[model samples]
Target: MKLNLFFQLSAWCICLCFSPVLAQQNYRNNEDINKALRNLVNNHKSHASLKSLTKTLGGKDVWVLTLSNGKPEAHPAIVIAGGVSGNHLLGIELSVKMAERILTNYKSVLNQTTFYIFPNLSPDATAQYFGKLKYERVANAKKTDDDRDGSINEDGFEDLNNDKLITLIRVEDPTGDYMPLEEDPRIMVKANPQKGEKGTHKIFSEGIDNDKDGVFNEDGIGGVAFNKNLTYNYPYFKSGAGEHAVSELENRALLDFLYERWNIHSILTFGPSNNLSVPLKYNSDRANKRIITSILKKDEKLNKHISEIYNKITKTKDAPKSVTAGGGFFEWSYFHFGRHAMSTPAWWFPKFEGDSLVKAPKNRKANFLKWAEQEGIENTFVEWTSIKHPDFPNKKVEVGGIVPFIMDNPPYSKVDSIAIKHSEFIIEIAKIQPDLKLINLKTEDLGSNLTRITVDLYNKGLLPTHTEMGAKSKWLRKINVSLKLGKGQEVLSGKKRLVLGIIEEDSSKQLSWLIKGRGKLQIEATTPHAGKQSITINL
Candidate 1:
């Protein structure tokens, strides 16, 4: 409503790429790769166009990936975005594969929907994953004044040990806030006051403060972590979140793209959190394997209201440039675009409630090995090793965990399997969306002045026009039929025959009407809930 300033940079940045995937191989770093992607998008002007946007937080443009199939202005669209968050490369990778899908599976899928995929939103951050610097990379691959200390990216985490990685160090500092887990010593828990907390412990990042800003390595270079920097509940001037909404140039660019395209019926984001993999991730309490019933039981009205509110807030941008980046994009899709939306973490590590050991070993150390062995992700962790530190006389650090691979970067080898499972899920989901298709139509030739018209309507997607409960609650589009006899003559039914109910795909209803026609007549069968179709009948 405030002019949706988030998309202000939409016009200037047309960040482009090359037509061939091979061209991308030449580019190194996100900046180059993003440019190539934009060039490729630019080549497809007939089917699509590429737009780049810069946010207030990020200095550069975020490349908006888009593609169109079928007749323009008439077909439904599916917007696929991968790199919305820097950490969610899997989303971006899937998007790249989605391009492959266009060549292999697009023909089969093009009849019903068009897909627009932006493989990597933060190529700068994505590039860091492959380059020499695997860690310490954030979204934009740019520099930031994280602590707002007037020093731009003057400090950052470094691999002091020359071990080729930046790892967290838990030292025995007298002023440390973290302590080993009583249940599992390897795990560190924040000291809880109500539960009789201890007095000694502290935690330090991999390196010392370069800028010497009193705070140790607080400000680092990179664009905003978009998930935390949006307009809705946007932590204003908060750490991680930049000066304001749409702070990063890339975020604004994406918002601008959404504003220009209104046909996107639903919004989907590949980022740090998700509804499918983990529904209602965090409410007031943090519980593993969350149960909807438990969430509702905690506070029925509040949870329901939050669910509805969150869903609505996450959709798309209407004003195009008004979004505030991180929060702006989600708001634009849901509230602004006025459509359904979803966001998911590219990867996740499901934690068990209790540390269940496969066998009772004489002694157990706190580490992911036992659980990793059980779940088969043991390769992700590295054992603790001793190192000579500038600050500590002889300090030891564990350089790997589930966070490094499964949460941070998934094994490239697992991409194919993960993609297959996710693609299947995506396709299954596509089957459930509100899809309208013309099934059957029949006209009977009766005696003079008498003709029967029947039309069948089917919603192939998974969700019905309205949920069973939603329908009963009267939350649905109109479910009525309309007959257009001529230019000026039309008959509209008032009875709500749609039945506040749910109908699965392949299941349909036949609507028949007795009309008076001596010659050819135009009959239009309309179902506002599932779309409409028309034909000619004679009596």
Candidate 2:
């Protein structure tokens, strides 16, 4: 009874937690959604755009909802886009949740900030979950002839085993290139090419190749993978990533709105790349091992803990194995415009951090199986079962794997926790306000017609005025204090303000300059995020 009550309570919280989503209609029949989005644009006092915000993509309008502090001209902006691939419901939910959070907490986060929030990038794809999805496919409802032999989504598969799961099946053939599951012994692996060892295996999707394209049903369904369609590493001539980067009207519409409206300083996108969380590969580029040391520098206990579980914790791939590259979000922010950017995985297979158990490599699959059963992710991947195949024989099909909604897609219960944690991180970084003000200025008049003016610059927030790299590269603006007296202001000696390296939270740096014969003079201070301030002096 207690366990049942816990689940009931969890179910209730799911409903309450996603009440915001209740406001969002299914994209297919989302007339109400359009109206709600339009209403938000009209009602919000801060600058917002409902005009030219939507564009026809694959025969439907994709909407771009923007929020900002009222400004006369285009302000630098950040675009947080989700539901790009259509299958990623968590992405859409998070982006919307974040926008809502920002609006409610406007006094703190939304100040001097303009945000472009597209909660659902692939509305067509998202509508699949409306009542029941046939095969759990359909992110964009795109009927593209994926195999290009001329039919569309025609060659699809199904869960013939009654396991309620769709997975690859391997049948043993004398000429095939896949081997029996070596690691898990129940799963299969691609045969090694170097050994010239023959593999007697043939792999097929859960269903027949309805189109008979000689390659099974490779081109299943849905709109293009939007992230893979961006211009930088745009899979130009590659199959479904699109004709070019930002080629889809859906992608173009949002890109146009962001680039035109906001001069974004930084971007923290949830994707498959990294900048803020550096892959080990970048450490060699810096040469200053301090950056690497700083991250690995903490908690010897954690280090010792990892040593017990993982033999090779070295990061092998910071990117996908695919050759068709879409110069992703990290590149767009970091390389193209020189903005600080970070892209993190929304979820990953567990790393052995002592927080999770240390399963032997041989027992890894079994451990995952055990945990999945306990955690309820087993709802997706069914147990390995035998099945008869037309092409090959004597094969047991393991329908269970990591391709499930539970782990790859974190539960709604975790959204609030991650939101609060990420929000705090954003605030911590946001505090790097370079804006210095003329807090105090005093002049002591000398009898010989000379006066000394002192100035103080205070850091208004958390992060220091400049990063060590920013200071060294002069990428960050220099804070200068000047006391001027008309033309040819008699100056004793102009001393350059000293940057005490990095300034911590709520710290102040002071400067004093001397000048003679002052009729009218001005003193000013500057920073990147805080705008600027100045004051006038006369004697």
Candidate 3:
């Protein structure tokens, strides 16, 4: 009996040591995510709180986890958002795992920096990954008529091959615009007419035209995409963009929460749009226009600096440049919300290196498949199989391609390591947030009981107190330097309250006041985005 009890206790100890690793072995569903978040908050009650902002159209809760050691509003804040694109499941995983790692190991980071983490903004669409028929979905559950053909969801994808996965179908035809690449026959590329290449095949999604409208799988179930529904450069009249910007519940809820949090100095998003691996360039023409569309010159310089730091910390190389389509939250956070916004896909297939005798393929798909083969990753490609299609009965139709979500997300085993590196990057960014300090104080006594008080308000942090674009925005509060006087204090020079327009990083502005005063007095410097500091002086 004693030996059995000892064995049972030993087994329990082993389970406790490896339980977290076991739980993270697979991508989590909505229920699992909710439970994980609740457990974190319950375990770390003093530093974490989870709130359900609202439910997505699919009834999944849109949760925001606030982590701070003290009052969240009192400290400079950073917003870490994930799942901006529904198809990027790795983003959701990274966001949640970063939060978990922070709560478990990096609790000291919360002392000066508050974090507002939006784990999964596209819950409705991300759920499709775990559904019966898996494909790359980007829309929510709003019941949108994507093709606008008067009928809703009539032309959805059909599993013709009975493979339980939605891939691509190609047809061999003389007038086709796409052709298989010569280097790798498994991958397809659009025929380049400029290079004298002739089309040999046409490719379409693995689906039948159920609506018989010539387009295959154009309109499907679900509604607006959260990433495409934001208010920056909104794609009007486009499918999945909704009737107007900020139309979906998830987008509106997130924006509303962000608008109210004036302490948020920067936003870090895990999404397909990337400005971290490679920074944005400044265009003089666009920056000078009445409506600015480019990053300001100063902001562009800051972006480059941060990009260098990100590369050094993450050791990520050869990151592919991604364009921000209209209505993406990544650009919206910078252009419209007026904050330091940064985004990255967080994971991609490593660049394929060929031997000196062979050149690497330029096509992304071809290169990805080559790298997958070298890494011994299996099941990423579905072999092309002949299938009888209703639309192309006369031609040879085959269904096959790279599997959905594999190219965008790494395998589950690699998630923890990726999350750790990204979490370190986030902590480095938080450490450099704008911090205000009062330094270089001088007091001179004049002849007749009068004194002159002077001090330099300095920004000691690496980032400026206000971004160049944020300085023009009315939403961001201005730096206020005020003097609190004793009973008999009189200000003979300098305004009692001074508004410093903007303070660059590692820079200072001198403020001097001629006063006829006595007894104890106080001076305070405050801003919502950068923290506040106060000093007491005895006259």
RMSD of each: 12.7, 8.8, 2.5
Q: The CA-based lDDT of model 2 is what?
A: 0.53
Best-to-worst lDDT order:
3, 2, 1
lDDT of 3 at 83: 88
Q: Candidate 2, 346: how far from true, in Å? A: 3.2
Q: lDDT per residue, candidate 1, 284-383, as tens digits?
A: 4432224211222222332243334333433211111112344534433443344444555544433333445444222223333444555575444444
Residue pairs that clash (backbone atoms under 3 angstroms), model 3:
none
In model 3, where do residues sit more than 4 Å from their true spots?
Answer: 1-23, 356-359
What tens digits encode model 2's per-residue C-alpha lDDT throughout 207-287?
Answer: 666655556656676646566666554555555566557766666776676555424444556544433233323233343
Runs off by more than 4 Å, candidate 2: 1-52, 56-69, 72-79, 126-165, 179-186, 191-200, 274-325, 349-368, 383-404, 433-530, 537-539
**lDDT values, one for every candidate:** 0.51, 0.53, 0.90
* Best candidate according to TM-score: 3
RMSD of 3: 2.5
Q: Which candidate would rank higher by TM-score, 1 or 2?
A: 1
Candidate 2 lDDT score at position 96: 54
